[model samples]
Target chain A: MASPLTATPRVTSVTGASQTIPAAAGIGLRAEHYHALLQTRPAIGWLEVHSENYFGEGSLPLTWLERLREHYPLSLHGVGLSLGSVDPLDLEHLRQLKQLIERVQPALVSEHAAWCSVDGRHLHDLLPLPYTEEALNHLVNRIQQAQDFLGRPLLIENLSSYVQYTHSTMPEWEFMPELARRSGCRLLLDINNVYVSAVNHHFDARQYLAAIPAALVDEVHLAGHTRRVIDGVPFLIDTHDQRVSDEVWALYRFAMPRLASVPVLIEWDAALPALEVLLSEAEHAQSIMESDHAVTA
Target chain B: MLSLPELQRQFASAIVDAHAAAQHESLWHDTLLNPGRLTAYRNNFRINIEDALAAIYPVVRRLVGDEFFAAMTRIYAGHAPSRSGNIHHFGAHLPEFLRGFAPTRPLPYLPDVARLELAYHQAFHAGAGAPLSDVQQQRIAAGGYADLMFTMQPALRLLRSDYPALRIWLANRADSDEVPTIDLNAGGDRLLIYRHLDEVEITRLDEPHYRLLALLAAGHRVGTLLNAVSGPSAISRVIQFGLQRQLFSELMIIENTP
Candidate 1:
C-alpha cells in the first residue's frame, strides 16, 4: 500500500473535451425528464450518472443513456464500490463498471470514500469508518487495487456522516487528501458533504479544506442538503431533493478557487425535478465558476 | 464490546434477526438517539430497497393504489432487505415474497401481477443483441432446421400466471386512463416480455404460443418446438406471432446438440 503512495497514479487522458463542462459546472443525469434533456440539450458543462443505474443490459434507461451520450459529456459517479470496507472488493461489480467505462468513455469516474457492505451484506447506505491506521492501510490497499483494476485514477468523495467514530484520529478532509496522496488516487471534493459533516460533527469546514493537498484534488461535487434539527442540534442530511443551500454555496465559493478548473457536477439524486430545473442549476454553478475565476485572476 | 468485525457481525444480526442485541452494551447514546440513528440507517436501508422495488414494480404500484403500494412495500422491504449494492439487481425475490405474503393472498391475483412486472423489469435490462436477418437465416438451409437449437434475445423472458395479469398491467400503465377492477376468475395469462427494438413490450400469448416460446426459449429449434406443442393451429399461431415480433433476430442455431 505504501509503495503506491510514492508512485504517480495512472490517469485516463481527457482526450480533449468535445462538449464537456470545463471542470466548471454540470448536473447529474436523471430519468425524470430524459426526453426534455435530449430535445433541448441544455447548456451545461457536463452530466454525471450513478454507474449502477446503467448496469441493466438494455432497458429504457440504457437506451436513452446511449442516445443522450451523443449529446453531452458523461461522468460515472459511483456510490457502491465499498472502497473502504475490510471485505474483499467485488470483482463482478468492477467488471460491469469497467464495461460501462469502455462503452461510455466517461470523462470522469468517482466513488464514495465510505464503505457499504461487509461480509457480503450491504448496509446499502454510505457508512462511516473509524479512521484508524488499520482502517487507512486497509483503504489505501483497496483504492490501489481498484485503480489497478480500472486502469485509471478514481476520485474518492468523502461521505456525509451522521455518526462519528470515537476512535477516528483524522478528519475526512485530512484523511481524504492523505488517501489520495498515499493511494495514488484523486480526491472528489464534495463541498456539500464537507458542510453537512462539519455541522453534524462540529468541525471547521474551512480548516478541513485548508488541510487538503490541493494538487491531488481532481473534481468537485455541489449538491443540496436537508437540515434535520432533531433536538436543536442541527444535522444536515445530504438529501438531493432541494437546491444547493446558500451556506453550501458559500463553502463552494470558498473551495472553488482552490479547485480552479475541475469539473463540478450538481448532484440531485432524489426528488429529481425537470431537466430544465437541473439545467438552470448548472447555469448557476457555471456563472459562479466563471465569476470566481474572474475575481481570482 | 465487539471489535470492528464483531460490531459488523452483530450489526448484520440486528438487521436480519433483531436478536443481535448482544452488542447493545457497546452502544453509546443518550436516548432513542441510538435507536433513532439506527432507525435512520434502517429507513435508509429499507428505502433504498423500496426504491428498487418501486422501479421494477411500477405496474404493481398502479394495481394497488400508490398509498396501498407504499404500505405493502414497507412490509415487503422489512422482510427482504437488499443483499447487494447495485440496487438494480435487488428485489429478485419479490414475486415469491408476494406469493407467500398472507395479506396479499386475499388478492391472489396480485402475486402474478408482481411476477409479470418482475419479468418485464428483467427483460428491459437483460442485454442487447443484433437480430438475425433473412440473409443470416439462409445459411441454416431447410435440413438442419430441426436439429438447430435457437437462441432467444437477451431481453426475452417467459412468464405465466393464473390471472388476467396482462390486461390488469396494460390498464394500469401510465398511458391508459381506464381503471378496471381485475376479475380473478377471468383467469390467467402467459406473458412474453422482450425488448422489441425500442421499449419493453408485454405480449400476452395463448397457451399454445406460450408453450412454443417456452420450448424454443429453453433451447429447442423449430421442429423440436413443434413437437413440444400439442396442436397444429397453435404451432402456426406461435410462428406467426414470432415473425411479427422479429423474434428470430439473433437466433443462434446450434448444431450437434447433446
Candidate 2:
C-alpha cells in the first residue's frame, strides 16, 4: 500500500520559517531543562519530546511545549504505543496521539519497534520482538494501521534487546529494513541500540550497520548505556542515565556516512544533567555530522 | 517454535510474575539465550513502575522513607498491575491500597496524604477549563441567585481527611528541608485542591464553606446548598470565596415552576 504521506512535501515552508527538522543535532526536551531552554534558546537545530508526557488534556507540560514549539521544529516520539503487541490496537491511544499531533504539528512522529504490553497488561518497557516472518508480518500490519489512523508516516525505532529468541528466523538488521519496506514507514536508527544489541547478541556492529538501507533512515539516536559483567557474562544495559560512551561514539562515527542528512537526537532521561551538558552532547553530535558531511560532500 | 502471542504471554509473565519466570526459564534452555538475562527485563519493570509511583507521591515517599516506600511499591505493583500503556495512570489505586495495607496501620494519616498527592497529580494534568466569565457572573447576579447551579472546574478536587493530612503534606514537601513535627490529633482537615494558572494550590476550608462547595460540586442548587450550611452570612461568604478562587468553571440557573 502506498503511504498517504508520500505525496506531501517533506520540508514545509512557512512564512520565513522552515518546518523541516534540519539535518543537525537536537536534544530530548526534559522537564528539568524547560526553563533554561526557554531562557537561553540554545543554538540547537530542533527538539524532541516523548508524546506520552504531554498526553494530558491541559497541563503545564503542554503549555511549555506550545511555547517551545514556536521556536523549534519539534518531533513527537511515542514510547507507549506498544505497536508490536499481539493484542488488538489501542484506539484510545491513537486518538490521543492524533490530538497531540494536531496540537503540536510536529515535523516528525515516531514509535519503538517493540511491544510493552501483553493481554491488556502494560509493562511500560520496550520489550523485544522475535525476528521471524510471523512477527514481521504482525508488526508491518500494525504499523500500517497506525500510520493510516495517524494520517502520516511513523519512524519505527529499533529495540536494544538482551535476549534473542531462538525461534527467530533472521537478524534484527534484516528484519528492520524489511519491516519498513513492507509497512511504508521510515526508520529512526538508534546507533546506541545497534551497538548495545550487537555486543549483547554477539554480532558485528558494523555488519548490522551495513545491512540497513540508508534511504529508509530518517533520524539517528545517540544515548548512554552501562556495561556490566553479570555471572561472568558481559552485558551492555541501555541505561540512558550517563554520557554516551566512547565506544558508542565510534560506532556512531561508523554509521554517520550512511545516515547522511538525518537529524540526530541526544537522549538522556534519568539523572539528567544540566542544559549545558545536553547542549555539549548535541554539539558533539553536530560536530560529527558536520565532519561526516564534509567527507561525503 | 511458539507463536507470537504465546511468546509475549510467557515473556510478560516472566517480567511481572516471579513464579511464571522460573517455569518459563526452561523453555529457553535449548537456545543459546541465557535465562538469567531475563533479569534485565524484570529489573526494568520493577524500576519503571517504582520510579513512576515515586514521582507522583514524593511526599508519601518522604514520610515513609526510601526503603519502606520501595517495599510498599513492590507489593502495590503485584496487586495492581498497570492497565494503561501510559505509566502516569499506574498508581491511581495507591491511596486505597494503603488503607488495607498491614504495614502502614500505625500511620493512619498516610492514605489521606496519598490521596492529596494523587489529587495534586490529577489537578496538575487536568483539562484547562475556562473559569466563570464576567457575562456569566453578571447573569448570575441579575436574578435567581438561589436557583443557580455551579459547575466546578475540571482541575478541582475536594478531599477531607480525619487526620491533619494538609499539615503532614506541607511538612514533607521537597521545598522544605526541616522536618517539622506534626501533631496528628490536632484536628482533621477539609481541603480544596485546584490548579491556579500554572501552580496547583491547596487551601483549607472551614466546615460550612466545605459543605457549601461540596454540595455545589455535587450539582446541588444554590438555595438547597445554603439550607444545608448553617449561619446566615456563611452562604454568601462561601459563594464569594469560591468565585474569587475561580473554583467554578460554569454556572447554570434552574427555573422553578409552580
Candidate 3:
C-alpha cells in the first residue's frame, strides 16, 4: 500500500467550468429517469449515478449519460467497489471505474465504507464492518490502494447497518474520521444512513454527527428507509424506495451546519417515483441549503 | 477475536444458512437480535439477484407465474451465486441452470426461452455499430470474390434450437395484444437476433441462409460462402439480402499469394 504520508495526486485533465459540482442538492440518476432527464432536463444542481450500472459496453445508459453530462455536473457513486473487503481488490472493477471516470470526467467519485463481497462471491448488499483497530487498519490500506489506482481522492460514505460487532473497540464515527485522516481521503456523510443505523442500533444520531470532523465531509446523502416492527421492536431498513422521511429530513436539517455547503444528493433506488418527484425532492434540499447558507452568510 | 477475512467468510455463510451464523453470533453486538439482521441481509441479496433476473428474463417470468419464478430464482441463486458486484452480470448462467434444473425439466423448451432472453439482454447492451460506407460497399461490389471476407455487427446474435423458441418469445411479449396459439409441434427455430436502434429485432432464417451467415460470421471468405449456396442466382439473392440489411460491417479483400 502507498504510504498515507505521500500526497495522492488529484485527477488531472479536468477541463471546463462545470468540472466542479456546485454546493447544492442533486438526485441519484436511476434508469427510470434517464429518458425524461434527457428530454426535459430537470432543474437540479447535479446528478449522481451508480457507476456499476454503466460498466458494460456502450448502450443507452452510456449514450444518455454523455448527453446528460453537458447539462449537469455528475458524481459517480459506486455500490460495488467493496472498498472495505478483506478480499483482494478486483482490479478489473477498478480498471472499468477508471475508464468511466476518464470518459465522464465526473466532478466527484465515492463508494460505501462497507464490504459487500467475500471469497469470490458477491452478496450484492452492503454489509457492516466491525469497528476494531484491525478492521480500521485493513480499510485504510485498501483506501490508499484504491486512491492510488484511481489517481483521485475517494469519498467513502458511512453505511446504514442493522447489526454492530460486540467485539468492536471504537465507535464508527471515530473510526471513520480516523480512516479519512490516515488514508488521505474524504467522507460522504450519509445523513439518512446515520438516522437509520441510530434507530436500529439505539445510538444517538446527534452525537454521531457531532463526532465527525466537519472538514472531512465532502458530500451528504439523504434517502428514505423502510421501518419494520419485529417482535414489537422497530428496525429501520435502508431501502431507498420512498421519499426522504420526516425524521431523516430533520437529521439533515441538524447536520446542515456541520456539512455547510457540501453537495447533497437525494437517492431513491427502488420503487422509483416520477422524474418530477425526484426533481422536487432535490429542489427541497436546495432550499434548505440556501436558507442555511444565507443564515451563515 | 475473528480476523477480518474470517469474519467476512463467516458472515457470508451466515447469510445463506442461519445455522452457520449461530457459530459467529458472538462476533456481533446483541447476539439475540443478530439472526434477524442476518435475515434482512439475506433477503436483500436474494431480492437483488431476483430483480436482475426478472429484468433480463421477463418472458420467463411471464411464462412461469411470479410466485413460481420467485421460488426458482431463490433456488438458482444458491446454485450459481453471483461473482460480479454488478447485478446486471448476475444471470449469465441462468440458461444453463434451467437446462439442468429438475422442476423445469418437464418444459424442455424452457432452456431455449432462457437463452433467447439472455441473447436479448446482451444485444441491448452491445456496442453501437456503423453500417458500411458506400465506398466500402463499392469495394465489395468490385470484389475478387475468392479472397473477400465479411464481418458482421457486434450486436448480432444467432441462435438455433429444436424448439419453437422465437414463437414462444413473441407470444409471451408483455405488450403482445393477441396471444397466438402456437402448436407445440410447429417447428424448430433458426433465429437471427440483432439490435436495431434501441430495440432488439428478432427474425426467422431458413437453414441455408442461417448457415451462410454463420459461416460469414465465423470468417469464411465470400468464395467459400458462395460454394455453400446451390447456384449463382441464389448466391446473388443472398448477397442482395445481406447488403440490404446492412448485416456485414466490413468487407476485406485478401491477396491470393499470401
Top model number, DockQ: 2
Error of 3 at A243 (Å): 0.4
Over A1-297, each residue of candidate 2 has an lDDT whose tens digit, in order, gives: 111111212222122224689999999999989899999988999999999999986677887788788789999999999999998999999999998888778889999999999999999999999899999999999999999999999999998998888778899999999999999999999999999998898899888888999899999999999999976878999999989999878877777676758899999999999999999999999888877643311
After superposing all C-alphas onto the true structure, candidate 2 shows an RMSD in angstroms of: 6.0
Chain A alone, TM-score per model = 0.90, 0.92, 0.92
Rank by TM-score (best first): 2, 3, 1
lDDT string for model 2 (B1-258, tens) is 778898888888888877887876677675327677888999998899889999999999998999999889889988988888889999999999999999999999999999999999988878546677777776755755576777788889999998999988888889987667888888889999997887889999988788877888998877775456785477777778877888877677666622
Candidate 3: stretches off by over 4 Å: A1-17, A293-297, B22-33, B231-251
TM-score, cand. 1 vs. native: 0.89
lDDT values, one for every candidate? 0.73, 0.86, 0.82
Best by TM-score: 2
State TM-scores per candidate: 0.89, 0.94, 0.92
DockQ of each: 0.32, 0.39, 0.35
Candidate 2 TM-score versus the reference: 0.94
Q: Candidate 2 chain B — worst ten consecutive residues by lDDT sum?
A: B24-33
Candidate numbers, best DockQ first, in rank order: 2, 3, 1
Candidates 1 and 3 compared by lDDT, better number: 3
Q: Write the per-residue lDDT of candidate 3 for residues A23-108, one digit (tens) a residue.
A: 99999998788789889977788989999888765565776677788888999999998888888998999999998899789989
Candidate 2 chain A: worst 10 consecutive residues by lDDT?
Answer: A1-10
Off by over 4 Å in 2: A1-18, A293-297, B141-143, B256-258
